[model samples]
Target chain A: MDQLYTPSTEKCELVSASKGTVKFLLDYSKSLSIVKAEGMVFENNLN
Target chain B: MEHQTDDSTLVQDYISGDERALEILINRHNQRITSFIYSKVLDRDAAEDIFQDTFIKVIKTLKKGNYSEEGKFLPWVMRIAHNLIIDYFRKNKRMPKFEGGDDFNIFSVIGDEKPNVEKQLIKDQIDSDLSMLIDELPDDQRDVLIMRIYKDMSFKEISECTGVSINTALGRMRYALINLRKIIQKNNIVLTNY
Candidate 1:
C-alpha cells in the first residue's frame, strides 16, 4: 500500500502548496480591489 | 502611469495609512488591465466599465478582512475580469472574435497620435510578426498563452475557466513560450520587439 501511493503523496503536496498559494492571492486581491474600484469611480466623475 | 511603488509595499502601506498605495497599484496595472479586458469584450467602452468593476471588486474585498496576500496578484484580478466578461457574454449571448490575429486592431481605439515615423515603422514590423507567430501556434499552446500573458490569468484559474487540468494548462504555456522563442529566433526579432 505504501509503495502504491508514494507518488500520489508527493503530487498531493504539490497540489496543496499550489492551492494554498491561490487562496492567499484570492484573499489579498479581495482587499486591494476596493481602492482600485473607488479610484476609477473618482476618475470617471471628473471626465 | 508607472509603478510608483512595488505591489507588496503598496499593500503594506495600504494596511497602515497611506491612502495612495491603492492608487499606485491601480495606476501600475490599469493599462494592462484595460488591454486584457478589451481583448475579451472587444468593446472599448464596455471594457473600461468592466475594468472599473474588477478593481472595485478587489477594493471591497480588501476592506472586509478577506484579503490574503498569497501567490500571483495580477492573475487573480485577471480571473475576476475574465469571469465578468464571461458573465457579460452570458447575458448578451454574444462572443467576439479577433480577425486574422491582428495585434494592431486594438490600437485603433487609441488613435489621433503624433507621428514618430521611424518608431512607428519598427513597431509595425514587430506587431505584424507577433500576429503571424501567434496565428501559427498550436491551438492549445496559443489559447493558454493568450490567457496567461494577454488576459493575465494563472494556470489554476485558467483550468477552472476552461475545464482543463492545471498540468495541461502549465504544459501548454511551457510549449507556447518555447515555440514563441523559436519563432522569434527564426525571424531574427528580439522578444521585446513585441
Candidate 2:
C-alpha cells in the first residue's frame, strides 16, 4: 500500500502504485448497471 | 480505538438489523476511501461518483443479509470495486491502454516523505500507463492483480476470498504479468530496469 508513495519519474516507472484497493473499488464501479425503470425488456421476452 | 469495533463487526451488526452500524463504518472509512478511489480513476468527479455508489451498494446489499460475515470485509469491498471498474470501462466504450503511464501509483502518498529526484521520476513515469494496463487486463487476471497489488492480500487469503485454490490465484497472477509484459513489449516500452 505504501509503495505508492515512492517518487519515481514518469519515463522510468513501469506500474502505477497509486491504485490502492480503495481507489480500485470506486473507479471500477463508474457507470454501473444501466437504468431499467422504463419497463425496458428484450424483444424476445414472452411476458 | 476497547473493542474498537472493527469494520467486520460493524458490517455484521448492520446485517443483523442495526442500521447505524453501517453509518459508523462509512464515517470511519470515507475520507481515506475517497483518496483511494481517486488514485484509480485519476478524476475527482468520477471517483466521487463511485464512492457514493460503493456505499449505496453496501447499504442495499447489507439490508438483504447477503454477506457471510467471514471476517474478511475489506476483500469483499474490493471485489465490488473490481466489478465497478469493469463496468466503467464498458460504459466508456474504451479499452484501457498499457503505456497510457503510472507504474503502480498506490505508493504515491508515501514517497512524498523524502525529496529524491530519481524516485520522483519513476513515480511520474508510472502515473497513467500502469493504471491503463490494469484496466486492460481480463477480469480474472485483473481481480487477482487487485488482490496482490492493491489490497496486498496474500495468496492464501486471496484463494479463500475467491473460492479457488492457492494455485489458481498464483496462476492468475502469473498470466496477468505475462499479458502485461506482452502489452509493454508490443508498445516498445521498458518498465522495471533502466
Highest DockQ: give the candidate number: 1
Listed in order, each prediction's TM-score against the native is: 0.38, 0.38
lDDT of each: 0.68, 0.66
**Tens digit of per-residue lDDT, candidate 2, span A4-47:** 77563432322222335334433332322323346652222112
Tell me how many clashing residue pairs each candidate has. 13, 52
Best by lDDT: 1
Off by over 4 Å in 1: A1-47, B1-4, B94-194
| Residues B30-114 of candidate 2: C-alpha lDDT, one tens digit per residue | 6556656665666566666776677767655665455677757766766676677668768766654333255666455335686
As a whole number from 0 to 100, the lDDT of residue B170 in candidate 2 is: 99
How many residue pairs in model 1 have overlapping backbones? Answer: 13
Give the Å error, residue B185, model 1.
65
For residue B80, model 2's alpha carbon misses the true position, in angstroms, by 0.8
